[model samples]
Target: MLLTPFARVIPLPETIMRCRYSVVAACLIASFAATAEQESIERLEVQGDFRRLSVQTIAGSIAVVSEQDMQRSSAQHLDDVLSQLANINFAAGASRGRFVQVRGIGERSEFIDVINPSVGVLIDGIDYSGLGISSIAHAEQLEVFRGPEATRFGTNAMAGMLNLSSKQPDFRRDGAFSATVANYNSWQLSGMLSDAISDQVAFSLTADKQVSDGFIENTYLHRKDTNDIDELTIRGRLLYRHSDQLQWQLIAHAIEQNNGYDAFSLDRNRTTLSDEPGKDKLSSQALALRSDYHGIVGADLMWQLSWLSADSDYRFDEDWAFVGIRPGWEYSAFDRYQRSREQWTLDYRLVSDDQGRIADNTDWVLGFYVSGRELDLQRTRRSGTRLRAFDNNLQRDNAAVYGETSTALSEQTTLVIGGRLERYKDDYRDNGNLTIQQRHSMWGGKLSLNFQASEQAMIYTLLSRGYKVGGVNGEALSRAGDDGLEALLQQATFEPETLVNAEFGVKGAAIDGSLVTRVAVFHMWRDDMQVKGWLNPELGPEFAGFIDNAGRGRNYGIEMENRLVLHPSFTLHVSAGLLKSKLGPYVTQAGLDMTGRDQAHAPRFTYQLAGDWFLSEQLTLQASVQGKSGFYYSDGHNARSASSELVNLRLNYQLEQWQFAFWSRNALNQDRGVRGFYFGNDPRDEYAPHTYEQWGEPRRFGVTASYQF
Candidate 1:
């Protein structure tokens, strides 16, 4: 379907001419504007509790939840609160922390090296996307950024980014504890404390635990559903201010989880039985240090170094025979598979002010990065303890220097130009066998014209380029199909992914800060896209897969976000996104036509709306609704289709030193389906069934109360 703005009454030719004229006029105006002037914007904007946050409403999209919002909710896990976001999707597997899918590209692909996640996650300035680094503790604020961003965050930022800020050490001695009991025998306990060991040194600690009976059914196994989950997290941060110009912090965090291994069964009718009643454990630990310095050659510098380690012990029972004739008939598949990982990263930055020097036309930044990862695995058949050990490692080194400056070309216009040069390398291995070592270097540039159309509004047009690094496949598909399936799984070197993005947008605030709105339209063309594909059965389709070069793709979309304050006690927040993603023609396993296919799991339309009504100074009520209209789960034309709509409600009341809140998700009891496909022994036989289904959560409600003291 072709999507165009609803109010395009003008003819196509005239519209194109008008847009070209506008661009020419904008450039002309920017050329005669003022010279260099230093301008800095705050990094974060905060509203009342539970509302989204951003630095520049139109520059990027950000979602933030302060401590107040965290304390008012009954949610023990971070994903619980994130579920309310329309673009944020999760898949519950054997692990406690669900797989995060943001902006449609995060679904599982056939290649492990191609981490399709366009989103980058950061905790305390440290990137956290390694195995077993999902659970976070005592977060003070969590920020989510959407769209192409490479200037602020180096790489891996294809679609968006997620940054989490931890609570800082308090000079005052304080602590609190809380517990809860809910349906399904669910229970939770949390505590936090902070104190100053000295005037210049301080520290804080936090710990939490959660246990619940999962929501599922298994008639074959008469006990409660095996989706039960238990998780614990601990975190600590120490800050030292040695002198007036320098400050540093040391932080450590850990997570331990024991969960049931469950994958939805093919029983067709029963919604339960999707969860396995098997035991699985996953854990991770990390430590990092950050330093901030002033007066470095008249510039500011920030540096961070981090090291992390993780381990997973997972085992499960699988159906050996195709017939379900016997009772308690179970075959152990991955009787036990152990995985361990270690990673280290170093990041440094330097920022300088122009200050009317060098024609006041220059402002720049210098940055560098180094990261490494290693994985060790041990596996054995469930029926026996004959262990097989394998080792794999990945090392990436990236460096970039970017300088973006806005020279006031005129009083009403600003011209901005910037560029970045980056280089990266990846190395991968299998079972102590080195497969491939690849390296690449790329450069990106950005140019923008910002015009203050009026005091209340600003219009900007930007043309920029961004790149996502390529990596070695972490999990090869060779183990998936077997007998012959493993042979088709081939390991091939991959090239980098790059995109050229063009955007035009407008931003405005009306009614004296009572209303704000922003709209933007963009088109992105990506090259050398790395995507997972199926192999021909003649090659012996098995689980082992290969990484191959995929053709290019194009994405065009529009995004709009608005906030309106109707009264002192009432406010509304709204956001919507429409996207069309299509890949170029490429040869399939059967050599049939498969062009113009939507990227896997990327939705065409997604939107969100919410209203807040403050009943009184001590009480507030909120109603929110979010929906995803169109999504395709696979690249194959015959793959399964999936979509969802969810509504949520929350009420908060505060009195004295205590605060309380009641909240519910999927409040309207929507039926959400999570589907996957399994194609066996049939590449050319497109007539075979290649889809599976598992239902998502139903309506759930809970209340929370917390004491400040």
Candidate 2:
């Protein structure tokens, strides 16, 4: 396979090149003058490598992004970091980067009903699955497993898994603080400190706060902060080494967000007419304990226990504007939703030690997982002075046992197999005072063969199966009319969805580690695919949405990633993904045929190119170009977003113990849409349908200063 040429290229300033050469020449002379300190400097280089480049491959397709990479990109959110990866997309809703879609699978909304997300997310081993607001200010590493991780993560990982590891306390005393000021009246303050409390104990703490006057402007209210943001995050960790072979860590973290959510407008621009813009708020906390023991005979044992609690409020102006915009329309409303969730999880695992002969030839692991979750939801709608409300409660319990083993059959060949058996149950109750219960048992697994073609390359193939549990539509049933309440209850229940996927890929490091590349091709078949649909409520004019088992679907894609170290001071990175999707012949309950249509949010192509140049020991420059081909927004509607391209840049300077950086996002100021919908939101049009879009961020630049001690 050959590399594809970049879509566009812009030339750099000649003056910038001259400045770089001058700095490089001065640095070379300083290097020659410090020959006696070469060994000490080399030691420092190796220590930095341990901190920034240490990586472990979990599965064939898993990718790990280091902390240094995150800092280099100046990523304030997960989407900022993942936007540069291959085969990844995000569905931005009323808030920021909420739902993530990977390899053309995942959901876009969870407004009216509870959903089982295809992608799983974990922060320090505590599940934050569908929530996307956790701060990454002190994260050490991010691992993305880009396949069905059923054997390890169970149902929630039917598509993939995202794991975030926070920085840990070490036997070194260090601290750092940073402040950033950017456009749109945005500023951030963050700091972290770590110290060794004793010979066997260490402690670390991190805190950060971010504030921004958002992009959108409310024309009616003459306000620019209607969609603003304010967020805070804090975390603490304690590590204890009980003995040479045993260690344990305790972690606690909290996050608070108060953000406005006025994203839509009738004109599809960055200005809105809403007079009563709503707010999005969240308060979340988590605690976790992990222990590792290496003293077991020929095996290592690990245990983890975690608890998470979250409270969220999401509201919006039901009407884009107050009445009087149209002659005959005089209607206004407000909608508010409050939700709280609590979850507890426990996991235990054992793996063979690699020191023994059997372990050297074979790798094996076994694990058990158990979790329980509870959720309470309340919704209120107001029209004039009239108000209507609904409340619901949901509970879920899950347990699974899984195992995997790989053995070397020959010098160049290896075979791997893994499987998981899971049991899940759900209970729900709504304002109608009726209770619904459901239970499911599922099996998922994977099989693969890996071949080491040469010292510098390897090729592999895999087949995997995964499933998503089903649930009853309690809220929809509660709103059912009296004529067929029984029949509607039965019709509202949905079955589980299953997927079978096959993939082939090759990865290699060439030119003595100066260049690295990975490519993968995959095909997936879905059975009884779960889909969301909107319809008229049985008893009201308000529309309602629910999950259903649509017919089958198929998806296929190719992804490629490459990194080239052209010189000691220059590096380049490229990634590209191509996808195709189709739905089998199926008719929705609303009498619409979605056959032959692409899956929602599944873009046909996504690509990114990035370059980094180090002018001298104190100066660095980075630039990136990212683009995505557009796709449909829903199965029931024909609305589509246009393809978009964006450019970003960052420059950094270091002097002794202090660093200064300047960064710009969306430097091109492209007008792109991250989300879209085709529906009637205004009553003045007599419910006539039209397209609306939520625009992406505009061009913004910022400066940062940091100090280390």
Candidate 3:
């Protein structure tokens, strides 16, 4: 099938544009620039006074969450912080927020075999994509990029990127300790210490532990803690300064998790009938080193190297109830999966020094990246006394070279261009003596034009291309037909997916820095879109699912974010996003026409409103409300989640060296669903298809106390 082109843009009403321009003009005329700068001293420092933020993606599409914002929301995990944004969603897999989707594009399933991630995750310069175990207990800032990052991140960043930075070691000794107590038998403890060990070296260490009685209840086992939470994280870093022009940094981190996996029920409630519950355990360790040198022939050079290893044990009950629930039916079943992975990465870059018109007002950057990963996965399925086993080993290697340059065409106009050439290779080997290899070479890049319309306003446009590598399915060998195993393997392989995106945006600070606003419109066209589907044969009870290239698709959206400082002690923030995603003309393997179908997890509209009020020097209040429209769960099914809204509040009291806070999440106790499926699990119904859902967290209130020394 041939790819389809995007439709023409729909023009907006002229009156709307006139009204926006009028508002901008009025704000400019009535503005009074503030001469004095305000600074915050809270643990999660507020960046309200800052008008500009930096991110490593397309210009004007960056969203930054300050430390104070995180604390106000009482964010325990990454999802807690991300939930307040627009055009962003996640799938609740074994744990919370295991997979993230951006702008209606991302992975929705767990990594069962060889797969490529659409979103890229980075923490303190180390890659952690698809591994949501990174602790945010001591983060300094969170930056989210909402479009393809081909030039900087390569194939894995086809959708977007999320970057988290921790507080750096300082010259003075500082430490903090915090504790929290909440409902549902939940509690947490965290600590951080940083000190200057010598004149040339500084060290920092952080640790966190959290425990909670999970929300689900296994009625058959008569226990509420069957699906509980137990997690721990530790990190250490050292910074060494050889001289004013040279520096080196080393970091090491580890995470341990032992969470429950007993989610879902036949009745779509919190109570389950499974007699045998399962566990989700993970242990991971990573190390990274970075070196930087300045004044290298009027340029700067930096190098980074990292290594990571992780082992996971994920098991669950396949049958929702005991054997006696339906006599003479198929016996109960269980599935256990053990996975181990090792990865290594290297990145090096050189940047030219900025010279005032000496180099024609131009700046340039060049970089090279390489990564290697190996995975070993084993699965065992048990049906009563009978057992079936499968095992596979896969290896992936990637290398890329990229370059970008920006030059001033005039005093108000600047042009930027960049490109990346990448090569990817994958090898897979199964225990059944079957082996397959795939290789792909592709190029992607960006072209942008930025115009400074005024001292307080700027507008920009960008055209970018992103790509995801292809792979072969290792599980399809079990269901090979008369065509033989090799032929089936060839049919199971999928090609690479690619997208071309175009965006136009305007950003400015109004009311003399008291207000900041951003508006953007984007359209993306995708080719060889990858989709998952299940196949059942008439000859046997075996069922197989695999990823395939689903012809083409298109997505268009508009996003806006505005922050206004109504007064010195009062602030308001609002954000909204509207999206339309549709699959092009395509025929599925089952001979079904999927044209005009909405993509999975693609919400139509999302919005948020947040406010902060400072009553006194030692007391403050904050509240936020976020909502999302219902969306399809998958491309193969029509099931969807219901529209829902969530409210959160926080109160804070601070004194010299001490802080106390009270926070509530889901204050209304909205029982919204975060994950859903349409597969039958009850034998009493003869395995009929029925919708099952995993609900989001209920209302919870907590108190936190912290001390600095």
Candidate 4:
């Protein structure tokens, strides 16, 4: 069968129709306040699980997709699905997908939080931290929490946090697997098995392999490098129910991936690097232990300890002539990074099982946390006789003590408050072989009031402070003749970045359980911002910039998330955001005015709309459309990249013991551009195009099958 260009595009007629209906429905409800039935139905919320509900309450600016949603959605990667959420964007240079940015904050060739991510990520309760934005395989759910949620998840949660949980054994001793072949010579095979090893223990294993012919072209080069990706993962868990009073669990996970970096195409909107591709590899191991005990006094105690180690190797030689061969310079870089991070937490809480007043009418929790990390970042670059080596070794020791208490002001109101005192110490070593020590301490607190407005509605207001520690740099050093050791000690000093956030929110369920809505307004202030910049020749081309206490930023925004259960067979989910980020006065190498510029990658407005329809008990269809307003790509702030939108669709069939589905992504094939700098004889003309590969998956059609026993 011959296929037309449009054959690859997913149909969005239903998506448009549903959007129109949503607008109409919202307007009708606003105009007919007297319709009590309409009002009740308009307040229905879509979250259906208790554990998920807990996550939502504290992980503000969060979005959750259930396992069922993953199965019904046609997405090749988690980021492909996440791009539909608000304020999230992906930048693929040439042919490689390298970084994930949330609220305009994260970017680094290596994963050490050099830019201090405003976003954080957790997979299966383990902090899946890294510099390059990679994808996860066989995930059960992806929980995204936007904004600085340091109080709960800690520092890196500055921009936001993503938590991924794999599916656990269901104790049914069931397993299934499937394979598929699609366009671009893409092939994938995946399967999993679960069974009880003993009366009190169970084990499960899942694995998959995938390969794809990348999309892009490099006229000067015969072979393209960025289009290949490979991954392997294994997870094991054991549960021991010692008794009603004591229970414990241990989990282990390991993963390895060899991913190509197409990053960008020779032409805009293309990523198929006809020449050589960049190489990126990531390997990680993690172990976690969790224990819980119920005391005689009705108190619950929980302890958790986790250890993780990850190593990443990246090699890129994008130049046709190793160096100085063409009108433009050839560039190549290699980086190796190793991170070992450990965390220990203890929590003890006293509670009254019955709602009737406790002996003290109070509930409390005591907690202590400690985390230590070792990071080694090293990179080597060679361009036309210029061989430069850079390395930074950073060690961090962190500890904190926290306490929270809650009291019922009345049957309809509750007040909660908590505080954490944290200390951070760092040891740094640079390429010149110089060493320096840095230390910092601070406190964060949260206060909130929750009011039950009625049986179906509630309102809450919260205020909190967040902090991120800073580190030293390797580029600044006065070299001694031999050993490349430093002659003078110019201590690299960076201060901590801090923010105070205040928010007010209202949540309600109405419209006969057909609709759910939540609205929140927030304001935040950040100080001592350590903005990032590129290297310039006049500044030596090797010198990185660090602006100390370079003014501040003010962020104010509104968020709305709603799910409309219009009918048992048809459901609609809609979310919208309006955000404003303003940078304060800061100095650049050229003394450029960096004030009032949108924080590097921060976007102003974002939204997502989706619908699910059951054509029959055996067949279902789903569609989603999402977009971001637009954002700046560079620190000097030269250009404003345009915003893009994506549309996706999926169809599924259910049978007694098997399931099958097909889906398409990036149906419109939109072009995404990034901001970069070109260093040459003319410094003023330094600005050049660093166009990114269009995120469009071209057009993909595949069938997936799974079974349960």
Candidate 5:
């Protein structure tokens, strides 16, 4: 795949055919109304649930973004594309955002713990949930599977899963080169080449490097790069086929990021006053190999092996101020944390052959999965003339056995059932006299019924269950000086949480494929719901954070995605999410009653309306308007971010195989917040509490040029 700033006219893969039927479908209007065109919307194949199926056959809420959809705009990272989707958002406190929230449930940050992500992230068949990905270099597709997926993935996918795939080697040689220059002293260069090395072998390689001065200005240091963005991603892949019954795939990727993190401002804007700005640095390498063979009687076998090694150093100013700001009374300090992590995974599966059904008309699959992780964490702090160090070692192991079966009850209906039994264990030890071990055995499953109403419409209902692993807080508890706070020690350990979800969805198209749409409504109940709780920040690092179970929780939402091919030259796309999330009877240690209140980071509504205008064979214009309602920033406080809307525009021109693009994101230049806090950092008012927000990107325009060969 090449990073061209234009979409290619490609054929749909595994799409539902046109059907002269009607279903009660409601679509949100994005722009002007249009007339039907002769062109049809493109369809995508989904690689979830251990099967390659179309959207109509998948029994859940799913969103797919292609290389063309991503490269058409100023979308460099996952966060840039999340807002265009429904009911998805991320928390940003690093070079790239770390926490990915689905339906208002997920971790907001990871400071003192090796937290288990509720939403799992897979990049090129390897798990990268421990760290955030900075770029999507030469990615072919991005798929977001919403709701519970415990039957397929164990604890890592309690909320959902995100799969990012890079382009594989093509049969024929193809490659591209791309470059871009934008505001804030930002520039990027990328190149890719792929070809067949032999009749049965093919290879692909891509490299991307992007650097920026960022969007922050430090007044004290007289520098504008206190918050910067610098990243490089290199990807390589190989595919080998011996015959129709066997194949092999190998993938490797490496990423390096050296970015600044002085984003907090005493003025609460894009300007800062930190004398010693912090840094965010990361280096990661990963490899994965997979093979499939059909030698077993009536069954096929598949296996995969993957490993990842990463090193990260995240540091930030503790005071958010300069030394002279408060003279001798200022709190001047730096907090830095470093981690080295290694992870490996192995998966094996057996599936019934295409012609081999277990029963009358049932297809079955069985799988076994196992993974292990080792992490070393180090924290160094400097306060004036004092320096303190802390070190910890963490280990985690997991194993699971899963199986699924699908049976055709009738020509128009099918029933699917799946289940998984998993075991998780965690061990932690630190130099500060804290040793903890925890283990859990859990199970999850799903039952789904599919009705193929027509060639272009499918209706399904699903009931699924998911679970999340539980672990102790090593950083905070390590500081627990054996003071009689045995009660706090008892709270240090929490239990695993589970989610049961029910969903009903319909996928269909009408008017000769001019109107393609999908709507899904889901409701989920959380039992022993896990939530991040704090003892007291003022009590030092010892009582900083812990995990607790809220007796109960509820999240329900409706998501819809629609494409209207009003005319051959113009198309309109709209995606929206309406959500209602509530925490059970739970009160914070600070006596903040949050029962019945909306969950943090859970917006009531999110929407995007976009349109494409093809003026000529060589020119195209795209525009979009995205908006989100305000929501609580944290559970400890009532501070919230304001509702905001953004407008984006892009114009592309194509000449043969060369392309040019003019793009601007947030063209309206709204001062929106990506993250916020309610804690006090002001010394002038004796550390009074106030809301501080990390403002989003400002208006910026850029030009991109690419050559495809």
Candidate 6:
């Protein structure tokens, strides 16, 4: 299906796409014919919380993808893992998805201005928000905590949080190496090593490199590597047992991505006509230090310090064709944006010990957080005989203090409350003689009540609030308005946005601990919602972007994650998200009312069902079905993506010290869209509006081999 403003009439063959359903049904029936002994499901732990708790004790949705799951599914990148989860979506305006959205909220992309991410990303305590770091070489688990985590993570986690933990040294001598060869001229090599240097010190190191000639072909330039992928990641860690009363750990990480960025085309297909194909490149390094002290009287003391530095260069061809290809009908232009970013964060916390409780059967925690960031950006544009450059810099600081307390009202009931007080300040400057200063005081809190209905089931209710700081709206506010221009210039900033969430959940196990499930329903209200809009594109860059506050918005959704151990060697998993959203009351600078429309990149439904079957002691098979409903591409345009469906499979075999796996993703070879834009960019049609799209990955097959020692 095609969705456009002027013309929205196009379709792909239904028969070809519908075959995935038949394949799924056949696999399900086949699994039922084979059986093994009953298996007992074990409870997983939540690592990002202030307190150590089981999955069934959480009041909201939490999804954890372990190393075992990644190995069986061949999930080489972070994007691959996100696609298998529920209530989550990512936007890929660049070479890969750097911006993430959870529960119908978050930023899609950033070109000229800085963004405050709604969904936060942290790997081994180093923040990677708004940066796409694809390699997951030695990750132990990826945890997705849905809903507002304001008390725990602050404003950056208004929508949710993605916490990735790396494998720690257990004072053991172990190692592994893996290699893979896949279609699309793709190949990868990764390895991990762990060793104890001394009785008091241990270390673990990981490194990975993946390269692929991406799927797009530049027809005009006769090149197939225009949209290629080249990424490398390395991580090193050291653990020190300072004394029996204290422990310390240090980690260092580095990432380099030199991926090409020539995806969009006039024909809106894999073939492109760009002569000046550009690149999306990044170089980043991070350091993190953590300490845990058990000698602090009646409480356990924990603190972490992390620092990150990144330099990125993103550029693209403004004109998607070679010079003189359309002669007088075309213009030759290229645009680039370069950024240098540095940030550091410190977090300190004290968790109550068994004997530290202020009252009987009660627990408490206190934490303090501080962060500082500096960002510099430069934009270079070359069009026709004109060239221009713009530079800007931003510095921001944040500080917060938070506390949480859990009281057992009775044997079957518990009450939990948490709150935080935060302060934010920023200074902005530009070479264009623009300067702005802003300060804000924000607060957030949560209240949850849990009832242990029975040994196998628990019910809970939660209420939470989250806040995001405001910033300057240079592009939109700088433009001259009618009678409102004077009033707008007086307040050239967009106010901060806030969200209040209410959730109810039930966690239970059935079939004698063989089945475990978590279900949650949440409704969120957005006040003074900050959203991205567009000005008239015909006016060019000086007046292209718009940022403002929408009065009110609402997002409500239901999420479920279930695991069933049908037999000792067979486990089935199902997850889904159903969403409904409205944009609230607002009109764009282009005079378009977006009051009750669905948010951008927000699909109505997403689902995944997977089955793992061990055919024998040495052989296993994994299959899954994943898909999402249709959704709009952006806030200012009507261009939307067609619903998509895919099927994935993997087969594994093992021998002494050696293992081999064959995998296929999107086996049905369906043509689906991942990014879309409705704009007037074509020269032949005199720049008439047209809907354009960037396609997702095609059918892929790969084989991997690994040796463990």
Give the Cα lDDT of each candidate.
0.60, 0.77, 0.77, 0.59, 0.81, 0.81
After superposition on all C-alphas, the RMSD of every candidate to the true structure, in Å, is 6.6, 8.5, 4.8, 8.8, 7.1, 7.5
User: Which sections of candidate 2 miss by over 4 Å?
Assistant: 1-58, 355-360, 481-491, 536-541, 683-686
Against the true structure, candidate 6 has what lDDT? 0.81
lDDT of 6 at 431: 73
Relative to the true structure, candidate 4 reaches a TM of 0.83
**Which pairs clash (backbone N, Cα, C closer than 3 Å) in model 5?**
none
Residue-level lDDT tens digits of model 6 in 1-709: 1112101212212322233243233223323322323445476788889876887877777888888867655788877777788878888888888688888888888877677888889888788888855688768788888888889999888888888887788688989999999999999999999999999999999899999999999999899999999999998889999999899999999999999999998887899999999999999999999999999877899999999999999999987878877777788889899999999999999999888887877899999999999999888888888887778888999999999998889998989999998999989887768898999999888998887766556777788898888887654344435333443454467788889887766677652556677777677888998888766536322235556788898887777777888898999999888888889988776677888999888898999999999999899999988899999988777789998888889998989899999999889987777777777777877777777888878888999999988
For all predicted structures, in order, the TM-scores are: 0.82, 0.89, 0.91, 0.83, 0.93, 0.92
In candidate 2, position 140 carries an lDDT of: 72
Give the better candidate number (2 or 4) by TM-score.
2
Residue 42 lDDT, candidate 4, scale 0-100 = 26
Which residue pairs collide in model 3, if any? none
Model 1, C-alpha of 465: deviation from truth (Å): 2.5
Model 1 compared with the native: what TM-score?
0.82
> Which has the higher lDDT value, candidate number 3 or candidate number 6?
6
lDDT of 3 by residue, 1-709 (tens): 0001212343333323333443344334323222213333112222210112222122547777776768767888887887777788888867566677788888876645567878878877788886764578877678777777888788877877777777677769989999999998999999989999999999889899989888888888888987888999988889999999999999998999999888878768889888888888989999999888885875678888999999999988877676688788656788888999899999888877754223768777788999999999898888789888889898999999998887888987888888899998888888888788989998888888887665455667788899999877766664465332333454558899999888767666653456676666677888999877555332122355677777899877777777788999999988888878888776554455778898888898888899999999999899999899998877766679999889999998989889898999889989887787766566677767777787878898999998988
Give candidate 3 regions above 4 Å deviation. 1-58, 355-358, 480-491, 536-543, 589-592
lDDT of 2: 0.77
Indicate the worst ten consecutive residues by lDDT in candidate 6. Answer: 1-10
For model 6, name the residue pairs that clash: none
> Compared with the true structure, what per-residue lDDT tens digits does model 2 show for residues 1-709?
1111101121222322323333233323323333322221111011111012222112346666776677766877786887787778888776687787778788887664778888878887889887774577867777776768788788988888788877789789888999999999999999989999999999889899989989999989999998988999988889999998999999998999999999998767999989889898989999999898999887788888999999999998877786666656546789898989999999888877776326578878788999999988898888778887888888999999998887898997888889999999999888877788999899999988876655445666778898888876755675566333333454577888888877766665552445666666667788888877655423222555667777798877777776777898998988888778877676655567888788888888999899999999999999998898988887766789899888889999999999999999889899887788777766566766777888878998999898988
- Estimate the overall C-alpha local distance difference test score of candidate 5: 0.81
Worst 10 contiguous positions by lDDT, candidate 2: 41-50
